[model samples]
Every structure is written in structure tokens, then in C-alpha cells.
Target chain A: MKIIVLVKYVPDIEAGYQFNSARRLDRGGDGLLNQLDEYPLEQARRLAEQFGAEVVALTLGPDEAEEAVRRALQMGADSGVHVCDAAVEGSDALATALILAAAIRRLGGADLILCGAGSADATTSLIPVQLAARLQIPALTGAASLTVQDGAVEIRRDLDAWSLQLAAPLPALVSVNDKTGEPAYPSAKAVMLARKKPVESLDLADIGVDPAAVGAGGAKVEVASITPAPARAGGQILDSESDDVVAAFVALLQANALI
Target chain B: MSDILTLLDDPAREAERLAFAGAIGRPVGVRLAGGPELAARPGTVAAALATLAVERDAAAVLLPQGLFGAEVAALLALRLGAAAITDVVAIDPDLTATKPIMAGTAFSRARVTGGLAIFTVQPGLEAPPLAEPAEVVELAPPAAAAGEDRVAVLGLTPRAASGGRPDLLSAEIIVSAGRGTGGDLGPVEQLADALGAAVGASRAAVDAGWVDPSLQVGQTGKTVSPRLYVAAGISGAIQHQAGMRGAGLIVAVNEDPEAPIFEIADLGIVGDLGEVLPAAAAAVRAL
Candidate 1:
């Protein structure tokens, strides 16, 4: 059995960020594997161990994004693939999914494709479904728990009001959320050995993607404008440390008619 | 300004979409109500919508912003070669959309350069200026949707209602807790109950198994905008702020004075949640 987990390199949200003149994220900053992507990587590693599956980690980004694939290898992936090209920059979710679909096909597909519920930077949660659509496969996304057996993949999803149990045949896509489980930390030995894993790099042409169909040229949507979110002026902080504090808080709620 | 179509899984959520479509100022030629059967099958729904959009000359397709709505919109847009954006908070007459990005730390105004535009309207918009009632159309699954046949639903169980608490999305008041709760939500629940508010949790609390993942609020979790949002024990990371910063009023209680949550809070109280939350509940009950 073979499993491919899609991972991404995102700017550390805590480290902060800035937008370029084109209103794109400045990727020349400190970056790491998106926290959410770890969940699927961990799940893929577990499945490889259980079923003797070949686990491959895949990512799409600029030259530096190979770091994300290397990180995945350290976490137990057998190998890594990086789809890196200048033309892939500034591509929206639609184009990104299209390129990923092409890359997956180029790799000869898999028994199961796994990924995070969403990328931390985009947080649109669009790629998994879009990729599934492009691939013409069933997508069981936002899975809290997932298991593969009997040539099918099943997952448990906890929605706002329902807990759904969904299943799809092999060669399907599954996007797992943080609830799946905590990712295991790579050992120091694994980190050193990860450098030995073969990392294949592909550009848009290699993936059969037209340069004009992606990046700024193929972007279906354009950022009209961007601005810092208007800051909220914080109110007074009551530090009385007494009963009066509770009274004050309640009174303020009443004054605002929030209760 | 051109033809628009809307697909809502729940009729109960129609008002918000109506208001959103009204904001776009276009004729909604059709409103597809995604009942149980259709809502359960997004691939089928997307295939049907793909045909419907072309047939109706729909320039835009709107749906409720949530997990289901996002799925259908993405699939439909891909099939139609259209542009899709999710969790949109506002739309201008010219089709420019305003949405939070980078975990609500910033806002992006974007527009589809060409072709149809698909959007999922977030909840909590005002009622439509004039209700434009359109015929509710039910579509039969298209043959192309047969591709979805590979998937099956094994079971679905509705979560037991939480003590009649309002849903976190639609609740007017929400009391959320975080790491400081020490995995004990009793105080948070009490405060929420006293105020008739919904219960919420930050990622820390959810990660620590103090609360259900469904109740989590953050960039990766559910976004909420209640009239009153109370954060207790949460230090307020940027991800957490992205989910709740839109609330009309924010009251934060944390032991740390330098917690990032206090920076955006409308009301900041420096104290322990265990003592402050219970006391606040008692005070609210007396009211």
C-alpha cells in the first residue's frame, strides 16, 4: 500500500508577517511546517507502520519549501516530493489545487491521499475538496479519526451539531484535523537521517502545468486591496482583586446591555 | 449586478443568505434548498449546481459559510472554472469581497477577475432591505455526479443538545475558556448558563482535552461573532483572536496582565478565572 500526505510550509504565525507590494505574503521570513499539516503527516506515518505502506510526503512552494518535505521525512516519511517553481507563486487555491492534482497524477496516484484540515496561512480549507474534485475522487475531510481497512478509508467527523461517520473507497483523499492526534516529535537520530532521504523536485513544466495557467497570470481572483484589521481600543483593566471587581464587571455588562 | 444563485442546506439559514444576496444587488434567479439527502452528498450537489449555473447564467453563487457550504462551493467552482471564496463577511455591488486573512489579523478585499464567482456568506448579517423570495428549486443528481458513488455514509449521530445552550455561531453571548481552566469547565459552564450564553473554548483548552473540538474557536476552528464574547483564562493568541475578534463586545479575564487577548478586549479584568467566573455568574444570576 502507498500513502501520500500533502504538507505545506507556512510562516510562523507567532513570528509575524508582512505583505509585498503585490499583496502577497512575504515568504522570505522564518517558516516551518504548518501546525495543522502535522496531524496528517502523523496519521500517514502510523498507517505506513501498520500496513507496511510506503509513505511519501509532498509539498508545493518556493525553493525553501523543501525544508517542509525534509521535516516530514524526519517524522517517518519514506521519501519526499517538492513541487517548486517561480510560476507557482501567487497562485490562488484553485490553481494550487490544480497543480497539486497534476503532481499527484505524475506520481502515479496513491491508495490514500492525506492532508491537514486546512493550511494555517490560507485557512480557507478549500484545497482538499478542490483537489478531490479535480482528481474525481471522493473526499472525506475534516476527519477527527480515520482508519483504512477493506480497501476503503473511513473517518469520524465532529461537526457543530452532528458526528458523522463517512467512508470512501481506496485512492480517495482524507483531510484530518488536530483532533486526530498529537504529532510525534522527531528524534535527533531521525533528524540526521532525514537528510539521506531522496527528495525529488518538480517545476510546473515537469508536472504538465502551463506557466500561463498559474501564478499571477492564471489567478482567477485578484486582491483589490489589503489593510491591517482596524485595532480595537481596549477598555480599562480592573485589577481590584476584590468582590468589587465582580460587581464592576457585571455593572459594565449591564451598562452595555450585553446581558 | 448579474444573475446570482444561492444554495442553502438549512432553510433556517435562508435569512442571512437572502441578506447577502440582497447586498450583492442581483436577481437571484434560483434558490436551491439542500435538504437532508442533497446536503449529505456534496459531489452530487456540485455537479447539479455546475449545470444550473450555466443554464441560469449565474454570475455568482452564494451559500452559507460553513464546512458544508465551503465544500460545495469549491467543487462547484472547480467544475465551472469559476472563482470561489469562503467565509466572506461583506460584498460590494461590484463583486469585491472582504474577508479576514492571516487569522483575522488582516483583511483582504478581492474580486473575481472573470467568470462566475462563488462565495459562502458568513452568519450574522442584518435582514434584507427587501426580501427577494425566489422559487426553491430541487435538482436531481446529475449522471456526472456518479463519480461520488465511491463514497458512502456509514452513520450520522446528532450531538445531544447542550443543556439548551444556543449554538456557538448564533449565540448572542459566549463564554469561552482556555488553559487557565486547568481542564475544569465547571466555572465556565456556570457563567455561560447564568448569562444564557453559549460555551466556547480556545485551542489550548481544546488541545488539553478540556473541551470538545467542536467547541473550539480559533483560526483553525470555528469563527464566531456574538454580541458579547467573554474570554476567561485564555491568553488570546492571534489564532484565537481571529475567531472572536469580530464580536461586538469582548470581555477578557486572565491572570496575566500582558495576555494578547487584553489588547483587543473591550473590557479587561486581571484575575483568576476560577474565582472571577464563578463570582461573575453569581452576580449575573442576582440580576
Candidate 2:
């Protein structure tokens, strides 16, 4: 059995970001495998270990994207596939999903496909279901915990108000939440083993995707403009615990008819 | 401006979506998927929406933003060859969209390249205009697009819940605790009781297991716009700010003066929350 994990190298979300002429995130900036992607990677590794299944890590990016696949190998993937192409740059979630689904098809197929709830960069959370659509497979998204049994996967999907336990057959996709588990840190020995993990690089031509069909031209949504979020104005400070503080708070509440 | 169509399967959500339409000053029509009386699944309901969007010739369809909204919207857009955007905070008169990304660090104004825009509205939008009587349509979803075969909902189970969780979306007053609560929600709950407010937790507190995950307030948890919000011991991460930034009034209580939560807070109290919170709750009760 084999599982495919989707990995993305995104701008370091913890640091400030740089934008390009297209107003999209600059891929040239410093990046790492998206922090959210770690959840799905870790969960897929666990599933692979238990069932003795093979796990493949797939990513689409520029030259640095290879680092993302390398990270997965250190974490315990069997091999890696990098869908690197110049035209793949600046693709929206829709176009990106199309490229990824095509790559997955080129890999033959997958018993299970796993990804994060959303990427730290885009935060769109659109590709999981979109990839499932293009693959003609079922998708159980926002899964807090997932277990496979009898060729079907059951997931605890957490929502704002309630949680749903959903089940989908094999050849399905599930986007795991960050709560899946703490990622297994790569040991020095494991890091050494990752060097021989067979990292294959493919381009649009290799995957049979039309170069003209992606990138800026094929993106569904266009950024008309991007402006930094307005800085929050300084508000009144109440450091001293005077009688005035409590009275003021209650007064404001009453004024708003909140009390 | 486009004629608005809102989707409703749960009658309870109709008002919220209608309020969104009213907030944007648009005359609206409603597509009741599976009728007002029927309890509809997400898949069938999604198909119903797809059918209704074309039947009514809608310019834009407003969906009540929830966990399932974007997936359904995207699928429907793909089927109809339209456009979809989630977490649409506002729509201009010219029909441009303003949405936040990267946990609210940046806001992008976008316009769908294609026609027939589908948008998901956030909770607690402000200043609803007068709502006109809306026409309702019922749809029988196409057999192939119903998507029932793709995934099945086995059941719903509670996640180590302590009690009946508060509905933070509609709560008028919310008292949220952060990691600084020292892993105990007692003082926060006590303050919430004093103010008749809902109990909320930051992602830090939720991840720490000090409060119920359902009580989490953040980008990933829930977005709320209450009349009054009190943040106790939260660090004010960009993620948490995305949820409560819409509140009418924000008060922050933390030991650190440099906590980011104080930046947007209307009132800042820099001190020990353990002492300040109980004393303030006692004061509120006295008032």
C-alpha cells in the first residue's frame, strides 16, 4: 500500500513577507516547509509505519521546493517527487490543484492522500477538496484525527460549533488539522538516510500539463490591489486600579446596553 | 449591483444570511434547499444551491460562512464555471471583495475575473439595512452532482466537553482567557458569570487544555463581533486578533505591558490577571 503526502515550501510565516510585481507572495524569499503541512506529514508517516505502507512526498515549487521534499524524507517518507516548473509559479489554488492532481496521476495513484488544513502562506484551504474533485475521489476535510480500517478512513472533523465523524472510502483525501501530533524531529542518523531517498524532479512537460494553462494567465482570482492592514490605533490604558477603572468599565457596558 | 440570493437549509441560519444581505443594502432572494422544514445534508444542499443559482439568474450568491461553505462554493463554481471567495468581510458597491489572509496581517481587495460571484459572509456583520420580503425557491439537486457517494457523515461526537458550550457568535458579551490564566479557567468563568458573558479561550489556552476547544476564539476557531470583549492573559497573536477584532469594545488584562493584545484594546490593564479579574468581577457584581 502507498500514501501520498502534499508538501509546500512557503514563506516563513513567522517572519515578515515580501511581495512581487504581481502582488503575490515572493517565492524568492526565505522559506521552509509550511508549518501546517507538518501535521499531515507526521500523520502519514505514522500510518505508513503501522501498515508497513510506502509514503511518497510530493511538492510543486521552484528550486528551494526540493528542501520541502527532503524534510519529508527525514521524517520517514520512502521517496520524494518535486513538481518543479517555471510556469508553476504564481498559480492560484485552482491551477495549483490541477497541477498537483496531474502529478498524483503520474505517480500511478495513491491509497490515501493527506494535506494540511491550510497553508501558512495562502491560508485559502481550497486545494484539498479541489484536488479530490480533479482526482474523482472523496474528501474528508478538516480532520482532527483520522484512522483507516477496512479500506475506509474515518475522521474526527472539528468545526467551530460541533465536530463531525466522517467516513470515506480508500483512494480518498483527508486534510488533517495541526492537532494531529507533534512532528517527529529528524535525528542526525535519519537526516543522513534522507540523502539516498530517491528525490525525482519533474516539470510541466514531464507531467503532461500545458505550460500556458497555469501561472498568472490561468489564475482564477486576480489581485486588483494589496495594502497592508491598517495599524491599530493606540487605545486608552488603565494600569492603575483606581475606583475609576471599575466604574468606567461598568459605565461603558451600561452605555452600550451590554449589562 | 447584483440581485442577491442567499442559501438556507437550516432555517436558523436564514436570519444571519439575510442580515448579511441587508448589511450590504441589497434586495435579496432565498433558496431554501430541501425546504424550511427539511434537515438537509451538505452535499444535497450544495447541489440545491447550484441549481438555484442558475434558476434565479443570480449575480451573486451569499452563503452563511461555515466550515462547509467554501468546499461547496468551490465545487458549485467549478460546476457552473463561476467564481467563489470565502471569508468575504465586505463587498463594495462596485462588487469588489475585501478579505484578510495570513491570519489578518494583510487585507486584499479582489475582484472575481468571471461572472456570477459566490461569497461566504463572516458572522456578526454590522448595521443591517431594512430587509425586503424575499422570494423563496426550492430545488431538486441533480442526481450526479449531489456528492453523497463521495463522503458519509458517520455521526457527531463531543470532544471532552465540560458542559453546554456558549454560542460565541451571538453572544453580546464575551470574557476570553489566554495562556496567562495559568491553566485554570475558574477566574475567567467567574468573571463571565459576573458580566453574564460567554466564556472564550485563545488558541494558546485551548492548546494548553485549560478550556474546551469549542470555546476557542481565533482565526481557526471562530470569528465573533460582540458588544464587549474582555481578553485576559492572551498574548494577542495575529491569529487570535482575527476572531475578536470586530468587537465593539475590547479590554485587555495582562501582566506584560508589551503584549500585542493591548494595541487594539480600547482599555488596557497591565498587571496580574489573577488579582485584577476577581476584583473587577466583584466590582461588577457590586455595581
Candidate 3:
């Protein structure tokens, strides 16, 4: 079996991020592999090891995106694919999905595709399903736990009240939540080995995607304007030197009739 | 032609979506997917929405916001060649939209300039009911997307959570635990049960493996806006606040007086949540 893990190089969410004139993220700042994407990468590696599947990490972004794929290779992926094009910048979720689906098709398909539930920066949680849509595949997203066996994939999805066990045949897409567990860090040897691994870069034309249909120019939606959120206005704060603070808190809830 | 076609998957958001339509004063046609049972696939939902939007000649389509809903809205927008925006907080009569982006650090006001637009409205936006009922159109779902049959549900079991966790999106009050819980959520769950509130957890607690990641309320987790958000042992980081700042009222209990959670909380109590949550739960039970 062969597996493709969708990874993204996102702006360092911990850093204070700012937007560019285009009202999109100013990726010029410090960037790193999206934290959530790590789960998919690690999980795919585990699955690959179990089934002796070839794991490929695919990333979409500008030049810096190759770093995401490199990290995946260090963590045990066999190869890497990066969809890097000037036209992909500022692309909405749909456009990103189109590009990825095109790239996936170009790769001749795979038995399974894994991705994080959502990105740490955009946090839109859109691309996973959209990619599945474009690929004409079934997507089991937000799966808390997943396993593969007998050409079938089973996932346990937490629906707040119930845990649902869903099974999907091979060649399906599954978006994994963080509960898939912590990602494995690469050893020095693994990191060095990743340097010699194969990395392929493709542009819009290479993937047969129309240049006019993506990027900021082709984006379907436009941000008319953006403004920074206001500073948090400090609410009433009371010290807890005594238990009276609890009484005050209770009283406040009472005053608001929330109690 | 109707002005808006809002997709509702959960009945809990019916009144809210209707009120939003009324607030915007736009004609709204509804496509309510089965509740609790989200359509097996987002592609099916997208197909249904595309058919509805085209059949009704709606200038815009609305979706109740969530992970899956936003994805379908985007796909439908692409399929229909329309504008699609997610995390929409408000839409004015003039068709202007308000949505948060960049992890809630920024707000954008946009108006779809094209012939058709799709917007995903955030939850908890409600107003008085419309004078007339919203238009409900029956939809025959299109054929499933290719390979959709590959995905099958094998079983469902009630997740054995101690609190019988309420649906966070619909819960009126949310009792959330943070790192201050020291990895134990018993008191938090007890407090939530006592208040009949859903139990939510900060990313710290979830990452620490103390709580399920699904219960995480943060920029990277589920966004929510409830009538009351009781944050226990939470330091009120910006990411955490990004998800819950819209709550009608916020109460924070933490040992540190300088915790950021207090800055946005309507009421603040500086103490151990292990003690405060239990006491507060007991008080609520008494009340």
C-alpha cells in the first residue's frame, strides 16, 4: 500500500502574526510546519511501517513549504512532493484543494491519504473534505482514532456524545485529530537520511491546473477590508486573598442571572 | 429568486439561522440535513446545496458554521462558481459580511461582488422570529460522489465520558478546564454536570492528554459562543480566548491573579479551580 500525508507549512502560530495588503497572512514572518499536520505525518508513518507501505508527504505552499515535506521525510516518509507555485499564494481552500487533487491524480493515486483535522494558522478545517471532494473520494474527517485492515479503514469519531466507528474501503481520505497521538521526532540519523530522499516540486502547469483559476487573482472571494481585533478590555478583577472573591464571582453571575 | 439559502444540519441552529435571516431581513430558503446524523458525506451536502441554490436562484447561500459545513460551503461555492466565506459572524441587509480570520486576531468585512455568494454563519446569532416562516424546500439528494460508498459506518457507542458531555455548540453554558486542573478533570466534569453545562477543555489540557481533543476550545479547536462560559484554571491565552470570547458572559477561576483569562472574564476568582469548581458546583446545586 502507498500513503500520502498532506502537510502544510504555516506561519508560526505562536508568533504574533500580521496580514499583508492582500488581507491574507503575511507568511514573510517566521514559519514552521503546521503543528496539527504532524499528527497525520506521524500516523501515516506508523501505518506505513505496519503495512510496509511507501509513505509520501505532500505539502502546498510557497518555496518555504519544502521544509514541511523535509520534516516528514525525516520522520520516516519515503519521498516528498511539494506543490509550489506563485499562483497558489493567497488561494482559498477550494483552490488549494483543486491543486492538491490535481497533484494527487498526477501521482497516479494512492491507497490512503492522511491529513490533520485543521491547520494551526488558518484553522479553517476546509481543505481535508474539499480535497476529498475534488479527488472524488470519501473523506472521514475529524477521526479521533483510526486503523486499517483488509483493504478497509475503520475510524472512531467522537461526535461529542457518541463515538462512532466508521469504515471506509481503500483509497479513502481520513483527517486525523490530535488524539492520534504525539508525532515522533526525527533522530539525527533519520534527519541525515532525509537529505538523500527524493523531493519533487510541481507548479500549476505541471499539474494541469489553470493558472487563472487560482491565486489572489483567481480567488472566488475577496476580503473587502480587515481590521485588527481590539485589545482585550480588562474585565473587573478581584483578588482571592479571601473566599469573598468567590462570593463576588457568584454574585456577579447572579447579577447577570447566569447562576 | 430568494436572497439566501441557508443550510442547516442540526435542528438546534434552526431558530438561530432563521433569526439571522430575519436580522438580515433577507428571504431565506432552508435545506435542513438530518440532525445528529450529519449527511454521510460533505460532497452530498454540497451537491444538495448547489441544486438548491441554482433551483431557487438564490443570490447567496448560508451555512451554519462548523468544520464540515464550511468545507461543503466552499466546495458548493466552487461548483456553483460563487463566492464562499466561512466563519461569518454577521451579514447586513446590504449583503456585507463580517468574519474572523488569522486565528481571530483580525476581522474582515466583505461583500460578495459576484452573482452568487456562500457564507457560513457562526452560531449563537439569534433574534426574534420572522413574521413569516422561512421557505423550506424539499430536496432530493443527488447521487453520492464517486467512491462515497467506500466510507461506511460500522457502529456507534455512547462515548463513556463521565459527564455525558453535552454538545458544546448548543450548550447554553460551558464549563471549561485548563492547565490549572493539573491533568484531572473530575471536578470540572462535576461542576459542568451541576450547572447542566457542557464540559470544554483548553488546548493545554487536551494536549496534556487529560481531556479529549474534541472538547478543546481554542483557535485550533472548536469555536463556541455560549450564554455563559465558566473557565476554570485557564490562563486566558489569546488562542483559547479566540474560541470563547463571544460568550455572553465569562467567569474565570485561576490561582494567578494576572492570568489573561481574567482580562476578558466578566467575573474573576483567583483561586485553585480544584477547590473553586467544586464549591461553585455545590453552590449551583443548592441554588
Candidate 4:
């Protein structure tokens, strides 16, 4: 069996993000792979190891995005493909999906495709479904757990109050959530070996992509501006001098119906 | 714009549509998602879509998180020859979006395909851009069958209690207790009451059962992007930051000057939460 995992490079959340003078995210010098993408990467690696299948990690970004592919290789992926082009930056979720769909098709497709339910930065959980739409495949989002056997996939999804088990045929797309557990850390040996693994780099033209179809120029929505959220004015506090602060606070709470 | 129509349930829907119009640089249309009762009705899905199609000629639609279903978004995107981008945190001038990847480790820029686009914006990322009222056309609800196989809202229960406080995820202002609270949430709750804020617990505090799991804020727990997030008695952890980093204003109260929370905080109170919260609460009330 063959599997493909999609990975993305994102801003490191811990570092905090700021707009540059140009009003774009500063990128904080270096961007890390979207944290959620790890789940799909790990899931793909496990499936490959279990079924003795080939797993490929694919990413779309600038040349710098190879770091993400390298990290995936270090995590035990068989190989990787990097779709890098200057135009790829500033692509919206749809354009990105098209680029990925094109690349996956060019690679002769796969038996299964996996993605993180959503990335941390944008939190747009739409890719897996959108990609599946583009590829004309069945897609499931927010799978908490999954098992594959006999060319079928069974999944457990959490729907706020209840757990649902769903079954789908192969060649499907599944977006995994954190219910799968943390992705294993790469071993030092794997990191060392990753350097020796094969990673193929491809450009937009090489994938038969129209540069106009996948970048800022192609996006249908635009952001007019962004400003700091309006400050939340602190609510009134009662007398502070004594244990009655609690009582006063409670009184205020009652007045506001918060208690 | 003749090509775009907005779908909403009420007058406030105008705010959301205007916000999108301001962002998208296009004329906007408004379609009521229906009345309060009709909006949440299980059979409203098809009606909502049909209204979108008829009144607005809405090729595609954008919804905020929690208001729409992923399945519906996908179906609508396909139906309109559009792409769906859920959880959009930020959009660039050219309409490219920067969304979180991994859990919150990085961000990627993406664009939607086809002529139409559907997106669900992440809450609190930006204020809805307000515009002058656009024409709002009310259409009859579509047939009920359009909602079949769509998500069903079983019930609307109040968020779980977190030591008598609202769910941290839904809290507008959170007063979080960490190890610095010394296992006592009394002071934190006292301060929270004073400020009309919800009480939240760090993973450490929750694991210790000093607070409920519903109050836990971190990678393993609820992610909150409140307008104001106040962290007290807790040292910042990368995991904890993941849940609250999107908060608009982060206020940290800690005795230790080197606590990591200070790095991301807009205001740092260099004292114990026990001592500082009471004082801050008093100050706020006096004003």
C-alpha cells in the first residue's frame, strides 16, 4: 500500500507573532512545521510500518519548507516531496489544496491520504475536506481514532457529547485530531539517518501548475486590515480592604448575574 | 456585490457581513440564517442553503466557527464551485490567509480555489468590520429535507462548571490559577467575581484536582481566545501558552520575575495573585 501525508510549516505559537512593517506576520525568523501536521505524519509512519507500505511526506511552501520535509524524514517517513515556489506563499487554503491535489495526482496518487484536522496558527480546519473534494474522494474530518483493514477504514469521531464510529472505503482522506496521542519524538539515530534519505524537490512549473492559480493573485478573498482587538475594559471590583472582598465581589457578581 | 450574498439569522448578521465586505473589497449581500428558533432547528440546514441560493445568489458563503458544519461547508463549497477554508485566523491583503498548523506551532498561507469561496473565521481574531447596512432580503425557508444527514444538535447545555465558574473556552475574561495560587482557588475566584471573569485552572492545578478538568487551559485541554486572559500563580509553559496565546490581552501575575508568562504578557504584576488580584479588583471597582 502507498500513503501520502501532507505537512505545512507554520509560525511557532510560543514565540508570539507580530506584524512586520509591511503588516505581514514576521515569521519570527524561522517557521516550524504546523504542530497538528505531526499527527498525520506519525499516523502515516505507523501505517507504513504496520503494512510494510511506502509513506511519502509532501509539503508546499517556499524553499525553506524543506526543513519540514526533513523533519518528517527524521520521524521515519520513507521519502519526501517538496513543492516549492515563490508564488506558493500567500496562497489561500483552496489554492494550496489545488497545488497539493495536483502534486498528489502527479505522484500517481495513493491508497490513503492523511492530514492534521487543523493547523494551530490559522486554525482553518478545511484542507482535508477541500482536498478530498478536489480529488473526488471521500473525506472525514476530526477522526479521533482510526484503524484500517481489508481495504476499509474504521474511525471514531467525537461529536461534542457522543462518540461515533464510521466506516469508509480505501483511497479516502482522514483528518486526525489529538485524540490519537502525541506523535513520537524522533530518535537521534533517525535524525542522523534522515540526512541520507531521499527528498525530491519540485517547482510549480514542474507540477504543471499555473503560477496564477496558486498565489496571492489567485485568492478570492482579501483582508483589508488588521488591528489589535479592542481592549476589554476591566469590570468594576468592590472594596479591596478585607475578607469582605469576596462578599463584595459576590454582590457585584449577583448584580451582573455572573454568580 | 451582485455575486455575493450574506447569510445570517438576525440584524447583528449585518455586522458579520459588513466585516467580510470590508475585508473582501466586494459588495455584500445578506441572507438570514433564519429566526433564533429556526436557526437551531434541525431542519433549517436546507432552508438556509436554499435561501442562500435564491435571495442572495450567493455562489459561496462564509461562516464563523461553531455556527456551521464542516460537512455543510464542504457540500456548499462543492455546490458553488468554491473552496471551504475553516478556522481562518488571519487574511492577507491579497486574500491569502495565514492559519495555524500543527497545534499552534506554525502558520501557512493559503488561497481558495474556483471562483467562489467559503470560510469560517476563527473567533476573536479580528473585530467584525462594520459597514453601512446593505439590503437584507428575507426568503421563505426551504423544504426541510435539505437538512437531512447534516449534523443534529442534540441539546444546548450550559458549559460544565469549573469550581462554580463558566467554561474557560467560553469565558470572556479568565482569571487563571496556577501553582502560584498554592492550591487554593478561593483567592482566584474572589478576584474573578470582582471582575466578572471566569475562573480557569492551569493543567498543573487541574491535575492536582484543585480545579476541574473543564477549567484546564493548555495543549491537552481547552483552547481559549478570550478578550482578556489573566494568568496568576502559574508559570508559563509552552503547552499552556498554546491554549491562550490567541488571547487579545494577557495579564500575568507572578512573584518570579523570570517566569515565561511575562514574555507574552501585556501587563505583568510582580506580586502574588493572592495579593495582586484583590488590589486590582479594588482598583477596577473604584474607577
**Quick one: best DockQ, which candidate?**
1
lDDT of 2 by residue, B1-287 (tens): 45677766456566666666665545464554332112113444556676666776767877766557777776766667666778878887556888877667678888777777877777666546454655555555434343357577677654565354456777888999998998877888888888878999898888887877778888667778788899999989877897888777898888888999999988888877888788779988987
| TM-score per model over all chains | 0.94, 0.89, 0.89, 0.67
What TM-score would chain A of each candidate receive against the reference chain A?
A: 0.94, 0.89, 0.90, 0.87
Candidate 2 residues A4-86, lDDT tens each?
A: 99999887755888777788878867789887788888998889888998999999999988998999999888899999988
Task: Compose the digit string of candidate 1's lDDT tens values, residues B209-266.
Answer: 7787778898778899998999999999887988999998999988999998888888
Candidates, ranked, TM-score: 1, 2, 3, 4
lDDT of 4 by residue, A1-259 (tens): 9989898777665555665643455544567887778988888878877899898999987776788889888877889999988887667666888899999998999988988866655555556666876777666556667788998766765543345565567788777876575689999999999999998998888888999887767665454434543333433322233334434433443454533
Query: On a 0 to 1 TM-score scale, where does candidate 3 land against the true structure?
Result: 0.89
Per-residue lDDT tens digits for candidate 1, residues A149-228, read 99999998776667888888888999998889888999999899998999999988898999888898888889988888
Instruction: Indicate whether candidate 3 or candidate 4 has the larger lDDT.
Output: 3
For model 2, the superposed segments whose C-alpha errors exceed 4 Å read: A160-162, A233-259, B22-43, B140-147, B158-166, B246-249, B256-266
CAPRI class of candidate 4: incorrect
DockQ of model 3, rounded to 2 decimals: 0.51
Candidate with maximal lDDT? 1
For residues B175-244, could you state the per-residue lDDT of candidate 3 as single tens digits? 9999999988888888888878999999889889888766889876778989899998999887788898
Docking class of 3: medium
User: How well does candidate 3 score on lDDT at residue A215?
Assistant: 86
Q: What number of clashing residue pairs does each candidate have, in the order they appear?
A: 0, 0, 0, 41
Better of 2 and 3 by DockQ: 2
Worst 10 residues of 1 chain A by lDDT: A236-245
Q: Which ten contiguous residues of candidate 3 chain A have the minimum total lDDT?
A: A238-247
Angstrom error of the Cα, residue B234, model 3: value is: 2.8
